[model samples]
Target: MDKTYLEINKQSWDEAAHRFFGRNPLPDYGPLAPSEDELNLFGDVTNLNVLEIGCGSGHSLRYMDQRNAGELWGLDLSKKQIEAAKTVLKNCHSPVHLFESPMEDNPGLPTNHFDIIFSIYALGWTTNLDKTFANVNQYLKKGGIFIFSWEHPIYNRVSNENSTLLFNKSYHEEGSYYHEAWSEPAVMQQYKISTYINTLINNGFKIERMIEDVRLTKEDIQRDSNRWYSYEKAKALPTSVIIKSQKL
Candidate 1:
């Protein structure tokens, strides 16, 4: 919704690779391992065309290479992120296409050309949901898969790192949820669970599986509990939701 704000994010992401990847050019899957493991539910990737929307820093791009999937493409609104991602892929001869484009208006890609599309924690940041969903549908081949993980709509209500947990309104609303991450303003859009499910269904996609959980690791509880997440609150409620869907 905020193009200028998102543009700021684009610039920030490009400049943060030193902070993100650091001495390790590749990311080490610590807590992220659990999240990455969820990709298995989408089934085998061998020879299947795949696209990763919001492929920040190309960490997912590197992960996709291990899947042996057919041609892989990653699209993001941040050209800075894409530039850093390309740098990360300098020596790796993989079939990965990294592009700087809005997901809703991606260029040079034909419709019904991909077998799987996956985005992580990035879809809700888009300005337009309907057009985004339509674009997802347009790119997937029949029976292709679409999966994404995002900050739970409930988690969007409160942005306080120091604020204690408190009950909020019903989990349906239209507004901006703000958070400070990597010193950049992260904004999320609120949508009911049904709105997300219906958007996919209306676009000729069927939900294959959905998981809403607050399962946190011991490390997450110990190190980043107060700042990034709350152990007690997460145990009481979900913080993230990951969904897998199939094009009908």
Candidate 2:
């Protein structure tokens, strides 16, 4: 495992937790980057057990709670992020189970317990996608869903500072890359689309849907206006990718 890179990224998340939690209130189901409603991917989570991986400050968990999910669990690598999540869940009177651990660690979660396991813009930070997906498979019930979204591999290829669609690295490169999105440098892993799909298949998941979410309409750009890119820039590139799969 890339322990050093993971630690650096974890610290970055810990430091940004306060500001991120402040900006995003509980039950905020706005799209992570793509215009698609990720919540709808679950097709009605009412009375279903759900777990969210890398759930920063528990906003997404609280959203599941609001949808009347049977049980809610969230796991994160940053202690500070879990601390803020605890506060948010407490204030909302939500009985959410929160754990602080990397996705690869499994965090001693129960097997075949969750009806759905999901993440948004989080899995990209993981150093070992195979282990993470395998751990998720252990916790999810047979036929249960695994939904996640992350920075598109092609999108990550371009330089963030300028609109030039030039790649300093190969699209198939798999390692840590630093970005100045936060006060401290943030590290994320880049993998090709085939790698993601193959990893899911090896972990006993059947690909149900794969979406390369590009800027579609004026509303899409406006919805993502708060991001680092402008309307024209966003329109010129694919912003994110979402996958919805089921455990076999």
Candidate 3:
């Protein structure tokens, strides 16, 4: 029998948690994207109750602490990640709460309570988008905001080869798929850009803003092709999408 998605991802993240402790944190949306200092997604987070899903290593929560949020809560699927978050947030100023749970399932968090809930490069880990976003809605108060970022739906289909860009896979194919020659036992889902927007709308969220621009200048694009998600490739198109929505 094959291992379940949750089981496999939990094991994978347990081993990989150390590499991601403080990487890709807040103040940045995603790979090669503009910093939050410029985007200002959550300006004046002061005294706001905030929650983070897939809160790997808790660095973003610490950032919220520095911004003086009223309370901080986070959850992740991996035990190693939850433990790392605890360690990372031990000395933080804000009152902190952490849970070990997958985003696909509810974990008794207070409903209609949080002022803001965000996930940084982590919403992609959810196996069920509707369930995940529904839980996000249940946890947030009326007019509260939910912000998340993920790799652009089209990023995986384009390749930079010998100074030329090539489109490989069919972009319309959206489902759970994995690269054959790649490593890691975990699986990922491919979503059409519109799929996310439509799903969030169905989940009772009002789309506030969506960002897909990579905001890089001539100096920022790298020539190296060996790197996974090369800046050269990201310069041609957006490597990630950031969305902010309000609970309606």
List pairs with backbone clashes in candidate 1.
none
RMSD of each: 3.7, 2.8, 2.4
**lDDT of candidate 2?**
0.77
Cα shift from native, residue 198, model 1 (Å): 1.1
Tens-place lDDT per residue, model 3, 6-125, is 887888889788878888788877767776888999989999999999999999999999999999999999899999999999998899999999998778789999999999998877
Model 1, residue 120: displacement in angstroms?
1.1
Candidate 2, superposed: residue stretches over 4 Å from native: 22-39, 91-94, 160-164, 215-219
Write candidate 1's Cα lDDT for 33-131 as tens digits: 234454366567777788888777777766667667778788877766778778765655467778898776766776899988888777776767888
Relative to the true structure, candidate 2 reaches a TM of 0.88
**Candidate 1 vs candidate 2: which has greater TM-score?**
2
Task: State TM-scores per candidate.
Answer: 0.83, 0.88, 0.93
Residue 197 deviation, candidate 2, in Å?
0.5
**What tens-digit string does per-residue lDDT give for candidate 2 at 19-98?**
87734232222233543353357777888989999888887787777778888898999999999888877854335788
Pairs of colliding residues, candidate 3: none
> Residue 58 deviation, candidate 3, in Å?
0.5
Please identify model 3 stretches exceeding 4 Å from their true place: 1-3, 179-183, 217-226
* Model 2 RMSD in angstroms: 2.8
Model 1: residues >4 Å from true position, as ranges?
1-39, 158-164, 168-170, 177-186, 219-226
